[model samples]
Target: MKSPIAIRRGAVAAVFIDLQEEHRQDQRYLVDGYEKILANVQRLQAAARASGVPLHHWAYIVDLGAQDRPFHPVEADGKSAFSDKDDPLTAICHEVAPADGEALRIKAEASAFRSGPAAGELKARGIEWLVVAGVWTEACIDATVRDAVASGFRVLLVKDACGSGSAAMHQTAILNLANRLYGGAVTDTDGACRLLSGESVTVWQVEGSVPLRFTYENAARLYAEL
Candidate 1:
């Protein structure tokens, strides 16, 4: 593992993905420990704002009229099983809603960078790192983190600030991403907040090939550490 590095506030931005009502209010998509995840995200958001880091919010909004992707889940009334753009449930959860002057990027795909000027804008502003948090650790969070690294941004993945359908799903996804997160590190919300505040903190980063060496037998032990 690499030593902890300081993340300057000016070079870092906070990216929050899909903290919408659909995940918390709808049973079909509710993540495990949804409330705790939101609280952590809120703490990170506050830290970012206080420390002069830019905040970017991404929300998943599916347009029912658009061509359905393979295996798109839908209700009997033709509405999206997730966050349909027209449904009230698509709203960003009030607890973590974007404040005034913070624009919310609405995306139809899993990766937030796929449809927005976020990558370009952040680069133009000289952003070198992204502190990422939010939902569906195995889906949207994983996709966004991968794209962020591919776009030349180092990521500080706030693990506890992210959630999925279950603890196992979330931990497994983190393990998979951490194994290959070349320029990123995995830290919980507290460490993320400290880093965002320009504090150097030791975080879990990929070191050698197969650092985790995850297997079915050791999965529980690894998840506990994360």
Candidate 2:
């Protein structure tokens, strides 16, 4: 069974991860339903601002001359597949771009907390819950959600606000995270906005260990329930 979660206005904040032009504009990296994901993120941003929830935006940018990770994908031209810091594609999407005074953090790694002060900063501000939304659900989004939970923060994962290269990848990633997302909850854009507004909302939460034993046949059914 799912649980009801109440997010206090001042104790919760919104986090947007890698909502950049690279994911939307680049054909190689564009996610399925990219436009719909951005629309949902925009809604979350507006709700966060109206409800006084602090918003932190993060973008992934590879250093121009820095040594690439062993597993980092490279194109035939020997350039990194991801955008470099100087690349115009590194810019955040204009629709959900951070407003003035909202800090835009650049991260070198998939998990924002791995290379930045995000964890400490959020803790310093007394933020106990994070409303997380962004792209590449199986990569950066998955990594960030696990780190946030391990770092002792409850996450309100915005499902519809996130996307991946394909619908199957996105749903599978969400299912994997949901199985192990202890102390956190998985919600869609509507439920997340309500929680951001200090409303009590019913969200999907793990009740037991490995409750969702995902298989190919059951994937669609499980994702639909989410």
Candidate 3:
């Protein structure tokens, strides 16, 4: 079996996914206590910028003119979610907006890599570790993290910086990722900031609001016997 990839500061990128304005302003679409999530994301972004780490932002956008497709529940309801390109709904939230040179990618699917250039772009920039934060923890964030692992990139999921409407779902996703389904790690805002600043840190997992660090001592002992 292939061992997990270690996340080093130099090759990591801070990636903010689908932090759209509409999701923040509208309670119907917003995750509960999203303001706090936004704050953490902003902090991570600032830290990343100061550390000279590359930042990438992603937005969820639907093609308004596409035809011959099955109706999504939102479309069947005659409500457009992020369909209009010029609308502020589709724009990244101002609090954590993309900087002058940061790339902002728009995607119609849950995973940013499904149809966009995010995967290739990161590889081209020599980024092998992804520090990911964004909204809807069980949806886009989950999809992105899984695909990132499948596509050969190590992921560090920002636990406190991601928001989801359902708290249970959010926790479930975090546990799933940290359990090594995709060999991804989870960290809070402070840990991510520290990592961005070139500190070698153990990636932590959030379990019911408590942070736990991963260790190999038990496995190391077993291997030593062999």
Candidate 4:
């Protein structure tokens, strides 16, 4: 296989999913390697903007009051601890907040396309491939990647730019994505940047080692020592 999967400028879009402030505040949902993920996301977005590739953001929003009849079927009413209206919580993390002209898609589930026009919008914009990054590697990231592939959009998942509550889950999700689910190449932020710049990187096939510096196990150990 080629080093990193090559993505042409016009055919690919950079997507950041569910990196909301709420997730950051909640230690349980905050994935390990969050700091690195945020930094990488910012780097990826900057590269995307400079290269003229479209940038898109997905935010999960739920209404707590309507527990009996929530706006989104999967989001049971009163189940969501935070609503999108919680400005601080719902706001995209400051490190990677969308800039002017970038579009934000509001979703109520793990898959952004399920409750929003993400699929249609991307199709309309002529996006043939996606470079996906963001929080909760095992949940939202996984869902969005699968959905994107199923919708006929090729995807290159940014491995280092996403995280999960635990290292095990994060690794598992990426393995499933590269091996079973999307069957696409996985790259880190730098790899994505190079690909977007029409360069090549080591094609990251699933392996035994984890490349991230601050893994969930490490983080848990450090926190316990605190």
Tell me how far the alpha carbon of residue 128 in candidate 2 is from the true structure, in angstroms, after superposition: 0.4
lDDT of 3: 0.73
Candidate lDDT scores, in order, read: 0.88, 0.89, 0.73, 0.73
Q: What's the C-alpha lDDT at position 199 in model 1?
A: 84
Write the residue-wise lDDT of candidate 1 on 1-226 in tens digits: 7468788757899999999988877888888999999999999999999997889999898886885676789889977787887889888899899988899998888998865788999999999999999889999999999999999999988889999998889889989888888888988888888888888998888888878888878876785575
lDDT of 2 by residue, 76-151 (tens): 8666787766669989999999999999998888897775678998999899999999988999999999999989
Any residue pairs clashing in model 4, and if so which? 3-203, 4-201, 67-77
Instruction: Write candidate 4's Cα lDDT for 129-219 as tens digits.
Output: 7889987887888888888888888788887788888767777667556654334567667778988877766665433343323454574
lDDT, candidate 3, 1-226, per-residue tens? 2122345656888889888877767645767767898899999999999988888888887765563336654545455544445466778888999989887877777887765677887888788888999978888988888889888997888888987886665666665566553555667787788878877666543234323232333433222221
Residue 118, model 3: Cα distance from true site in angstroms: 2.0
Worst 10 residues of 2 by lDDT: 63-72
Error of 3 at 1 (Å): 18
Clashing pairs in 2: none
The candidate with the higher TM-score, 2 or 4, is: 2
Candidate 4 residues lying further than 4 Å off, grouped into runs, are 1-4, 66-79, 82-84, 181-183, 205-226
Model 3 ranges off by over 4 Å: 1-9, 75-87, 205-226
TM-score of each: 0.95, 0.96, 0.81, 0.80
